[model samples]
Target: MAASEKQVVVVGVDESDYGVHALEWTIDHLFAPSMPDYPFKLIVVHARPSAASTAGLVGPGAAEVFPIVDADLKRSAARLVQKAKDLCASKSVHDVTIEVVEGDARNVLCDAVQKHNASILVVGSHGYGAIKRAVLGSVSDYCAHHAHCTVMIVKKPKAKH
Candidate 1:
């Protein structure tokens, strides 16, 4: 089947283990080789925060710091994409696209869904408390309401003491 004919499944990932676990869950449950002729195309997306947004500072030395911070962010993004690719490869999922988009996670993910014409948008929940989620503005929550497709928020299981 042509690429365009396949239903797109966009998975939003980050450096967090929660995001990684979500990807794993999506693969294991939806993209398993055991499934007969899975017609969905997998696209892994990483939203990379810009240096200025992450630096959280504006001062005399800010200009000088931007380059270094930007480089670090680029490296981090590369690693994140590689990790996602590696995970997919380990699962025998070779026909996958990995993207690193520079923006807030919520916006990037939603845009990716539109750009890819995705049928499903998968995100990992941080499982924050009400106060923390309110303060930080949960990306999963935002995407769940704003994304144009079905959104799946995967929550990682907590470890037992």
Candidate 2:
């Protein structure tokens, strides 16, 4: 890959408390120093299930409720993206884009990185250990293990004592 070509920097955009911080740190720590001849781009992905049609539903059916919930999730995703972008702009970062993906966050982010041939996958670590992660599951660990590209696991800034 040439230095002038732009590589995709995909990040999860959701209400997760650390998502915004991950976005900010990525722009500052990764892209700013490594921006090639081309400007960097960010894809903010929010995943959810696709809507199911309820036109044929009667008194109570999954159809009526499913679409509304999915719609709400997309809206939330949009908000996260906006907040991230706004933060970036406030800090003078550019070349950012937001997107919503309807699926599992881990699967969606991984797929996107592959599809975009991403150079690095930036994710936040909620500090789940191996045993706990095995049961509860951690997106950061999943991406680090499954992503075809390099993965950057970001932990929350250590709290002040």
Candidate 3:
């Protein structure tokens, strides 16, 4: 199939192990070279929190602090994207595209699906409890409901004790 004719699969990733595991699982399952023809294009997306949002502060030397915080956020985003790229490379999935969008993960991922006309959106579950999920707002849950395409929430298997 031509490049543009391939279906797009967008995976949201973070620094968490769950996110890494999801990407790995997606690669192993969906992008396996053994498949006759690769019909899916992989897009790895990282949602970066803006420095102002992360800082959650204003006034009183906030101006001086903003630039420093922004720089740190940029570095963190670079590291996260690099890690995702390295993982894809290690899996022999080099045709993947990586994006760093500054916003909430849920919105960024949903927008990515629309922007890329994705057929599937995959995200890792943090496995938070109900109360925690309520407080923190689950990105996978939100994407599952709001994204136009199919959504897959990859959960890390519980470790054997």
Which candidate ranks first by lDDT, i.e. highest? 1
Error of 3 at 96 (Å): 0.9
Q: Per-residue lDDT of 1-161 in model 2, one digit per residue for the tens? A: 66777778887655766776777787777656444433556766665545552133445676667777667766776777678878777766666766777777789999989878887888877777789989979888788889998888877787899
Report model 3's TM-score to 2 decimal places.
0.95
For model 2, state the Cα shift of residue 69 in Å.
1.3
Q: Give per-residue CA lDDT, model 3, range 62-82, as digits (tens).
A: 888889999999998899888
Q: TM-scores across all candidates? A: 0.95, 0.79, 0.95
Residues 1-161, candidate 1, lDDT per residue (tens digit)?
57558899999999999999999999998988887567888999999999999998788999999889999999999998889989998998888999998999999999999999999999999999999999999999999999999999999999999
Judged by TM-score relative to the true structure, which candidate is superior, 1 or 2?
1
The candidate scoring highest on TM-score is: 1
Ranking by lDDT: 1, 3, 2
Off by over 4 Å in 3: 1-4
lDDT of 3 at 138: 97
